[model samples]
Every structure is written in C-alpha cells, then in structure tokens.
Target: MSPTNNKKAMCRYAGAQNQNVQRTALPEIIDRIVNSLDDPECFAHIGEEPIHFSTSVREMIEKFRNILFPGYFSDAKIDSVNVSYHMGQEITRLYDILSRQIIHVLRHDCLRYDRECSECERRGNEAAFCVIEQIPVLRQKLAADVRAAYDGDPAAKSHDEIIFSYPGLYAITVHRIANILHQRSIPKLPRIMSELAHSLTGIDIHPGATIGERFVIDHGTGIVIGETSVIGDNVRIYQNVTIGALSLPKDAGEKLRWAKRHPTIEDDVIIYSGATVLGGDTVIGARSVVGGNVWLTRSIPADTKIFMEEPRLIIKNQPKETDSEGN
Candidate 1:
C-alpha cells in the first residue's frame, strides 16, 4: 500500500473508534438513577411542606402589627380619615388568609379523632370559629403587651417605638396568637406560631404556657418558656432566662416521654438575665426578684429577693502546744 493511503485509513479507523466510545459511554454517563420504589408518591406527598408558609405567617404578623399600629409599620400616607376603614379591610383579609392556612395545617398535621362523630365535629367547628372570632380580644392583649413593653423598657421613646421596633413585642405577639389557638385546641397551629417566633426572635415560648397580660420579655434571645409554664402579669424576663425542667419521666424502657416540666412565674416578678428556674414545682412568687445568673430549682416565697453572694474561704491551723508536755 502507498504511504498516503495507509495514513488516511489509520485516521478513519481512529475516528470510528472515538465515535464508538462516545456512543457507548454517553448514555450511562448522563442517565439519572431514580429509586422508583423508594419514593413512589408525588413530591407533595413525600417531601415536607415548604417553609415559606412560615415566612407567610411572619408577613401576616407584620400585617397585623400594621393594623394594630397604623402609620408606624404600614404606609405613612394613612391618616385619621381613612385609617379605620383601611385597618378593617386589611384585618378582614388577614383573618381570611390565616383561617384558611390554619385550617389546612390542622387538617393535615393534627390527628382528627373527633371527625367521625357529628356532635364532636360541630363542637370543634364552634370552638375553632369562636377562637377565630376572638381576634379583637387578641388585639386588646397585644395592646397590653405594647403597654408592658413601654413600661418595662427605660429607653423606649413611646408606645409607637415599642410597637414598631421591639423584639419583645414581636415575641409577645406570637405568644398571644399561639395562646389563642392553644386555648381553642386547634392542634399544630400554636406550635407553628411559636416556632415562627422562635425562628425570628430566638425565643421559644410554648403555646401551652399560660401567660397573663402585661408580660414583657426584654432582649428575648435564648429565652425558653416551656409548656405548662404559667407567667403572670407585669412579669419581665431578660435574655438567656430558662423556665425549664429539672427531671424527666421515663417509660418502662427508660425512654423519656413528654411530660409537664417548667416553672411558674407569679405576678410582678422580675427574672434577670441568665437565670434558670427549673422543675415543675418551682414557683417564683409574686413581687419577688430573681437575680441574674442564679440557678433556682425550688419554689420561692412572695415578696422575696433571691440573689447570689460571694462565698468566703476560711483556713484554720490546729494549735501545736499541749500535745507533748515534754516538748
């Protein structure tokens, strides 16, 4: 064979081999392996719900705040002439949206054992409707919360400032909302509300915690008020305060189950920062003060002040005289 013919033949052979290699490897390389048996359900059924609903809840909270405090959070163009009308419209819309979302969450997440009985369903509907009807009362509670914030914070310029720019107010707002749902026994809504606040404010206040009016939480980060914790009126808690539990009830296999664990803070009390008041029986009495960085596990008396004092160290030397008379 001639040199030119041999070179052309070799070049064609190499091109053919490369084309065969690409064809064999491309399908396996780009193909996706989906486990059909693992997730046979749709994405909505298999995957968790989107967390954007929590963001929506936050937005709804902001809207409620704007409704409560006009011109502070909402558009500044609103004035006395049309403020009421605008607020009414906004509140109605918010109520509709919130009701639908809450109902959806309840139907999906909460176990509905009463749905079989007609009477139970009727009562549940009535209770849910009644709680939804209490938005005005919730608004009144929020007003009290704003008052509490203003009263507690020395640097607060006005009620408007507290309403517009306070994390305490935000946490209390979520608590009030969750408290209402909890009282209504609409499951899952309250936790969602509390957790939404937790994500935003770093304050985990269980909805089951019965908090009275005029409760203020100052610098609320790392503050945990557990379920069954009852906080009284005009109570103030600083950051890193934990109303927690000291013990747990274990099952037969020693697995810890949910139990009532937390403290109760009575009226007119002040719990300073980094204080831990634990145990279900630990009751902080009314008009008492708990100092910062104190760990309390016992109940305190009313009108008592508990604080930390520095410990004294003493060293004593035994007398060397009298043991050996001769020496």
Candidate 2:
C-alpha cells in the first residue's frame, strides 16, 4: 500500500478514537452524577426523619450543660456575678427547646399508636410538661456525676476539670440525661443520646441501664453497659470493661435472638480494666473487687476479690517400653 493511503487510514482511526473518548469523558459522567442534586429534598433528606428533631434535642443538651457547669461549657461568659443570670437564661431556653424536641422524639419513637385516643395530644403535651419539670432532677444527676468524677479521679484538679477534661464524665453526663428520658418512656431519644455519647467517648452505656448516684468511670474507653444492667451507687470501673450478656433469648423455633443479657453490678464494686461481667443472672456483690482481664459470669458474694491465678503445670516423663524382656 502507498504511504499516503496508510497515513489517511491512521488519521481516520485517530479521529474515531477521539470521538469515542469524548463520548465517555469524565465531565459527562460527572454531569450525570450531579443531576441527582437537582432535587433539594433528595439531597437534604437522609437517614431517619427525626435527625433534625434529634439535633434540636442535642442543642437542649448543650444548653443544659452550659447552664449546669457554667464556665466549663458554652461560649457564654460566666463568672461568680453573672452565673445566676446566665444559668436562668440557659435553663429557660433549654426548657423551651427540650419541650419541643422531646415531644417530637416521643411522638416519632415512643407513644404507641394503638394507645392514642381523643385526648392523645393533651396527654403528650402533659408528658412534655412533666419532662420540662424533670430538668432540675436531670441537673441534680449531672451534678452528682461531676462530684463522682472529682471524687474518683485523683488526676482531676477540680469539678471543673471533670466537667471540661474527662471524657468519662461527659459520657456519664449524657448517660444520665438519656436514662431520665428512657425512664420517662421518651423512646428513641435516649438511645440516640447514648449512641451520641458512645461515638464521642467510646463508652457504650445503654440508657435503660439503671445507674445509681455517684457512679464513676475512669479512662472509660471501650466500656459497655448493657440494657437492664443495674449499677449501684459509688460503683467505679476502668477502661475496656464490659458488663454484657452471657446468653440471649431463644425463639419458639430455638433460634437465638439478641436480648437482655448483661449483669448487675452492686454498690461499692470496683471493676478494673479489661474485666467483663456477662449475663443478667450474674451479679457482682457490694464491696467486691474484680481484677483486670477477668471474665465473670456467675454471681460473687459480698466483699470478695475476684481474680485469676496462673495455672501450674507439672511435666511427667513416661517410662520407655521394654522390648521382649528388657532387650
């Protein structure tokens, strides 16, 4: 073939390749992807619909914390002089926000549709009013948490340090708030609050777990307290401790379903790091000390120290078999 004919064929081939490349270019693909953004609601709405409601609830938490701790949290300037005024303002604002968010969360998550009668809205409004009334109780619980942190951690300089610096205190604070909400039967808000704390502090405490006053958790990473797990007053636990379940429930078909399975920790019990107490039937008696890395399933008596000792091994030498009358 002639060089001119070959060159012409090559040019045609290059032009065809260029057209094909343009057909599937990055910009065109990006335009197709960008088309989904045209609907604002499609881009805006994701996850559960109550997320915005949850955000409002969290804002109330922030305001409550600001009011309770004053100088430790919130951007507002709080000193001895303006503390009362600032607290009052924050509390009032928090009450309003809490009423709205709590009602929304309760309607979306808790209130059984079957139980709703003609006076359902009135009952809900009354419940919301009761929740607002309970804010002082929540504040008292938070104060107790701060006191617990201060008493428990030697490294904590003051109550302010516990409020500002300790993640455990933060987690406990959230847990206390969630616990109150859970007790009020406010549904998904408590779990959401607990999960929010878990995400931030690495402490997964179920809101349904009944924890008494002065409960202290130190260096509280990877700590999990299961639902129905009752923690007594002045109970102290370290990092990497799990109070979980031993056995789950089985269905009629004998299929195991994840159910309430964690243990109950009695008062004055100190669980060291890496200790796991499993099963609802298992109980750690009062004033007992559970050592680090110990796995406990059974109930311990009061004032007992639970620990594991290293097992001793004895090596035995077996006698050699004699071949046909000691060869």
Which model scores highest in lDDT?
2
User: Candidate 1 residues 211-278, lDDT tens each?
Assistant: 99888889889999988898988899999999987756464224423455778899999999999999
Which digits, one per residue and each the tens of the lDDT, describe model 2 over residues 33-130? 78876776775333333444456656766876776566777777778898889877877787667666656655544333434433434545665567
The RMSD (Cα, Å) of candidate 2 is: 10.2
Poorly placed runs, candidate 1 (over 4 Å)? 1-52, 110-132, 249-259, 311-327
TM-score per candidate, chains pooled: 0.73, 0.73
lDDT values of the candidates?
0.78, 0.79
Cα error, residue 263 of model 2, in Å, equals 1.3
Q: What is the Cα-based lDDT of residue 43 in candidate 2?
A: 51
Model 2: colliding residue pairs: 244-262, 245-261, 246-279
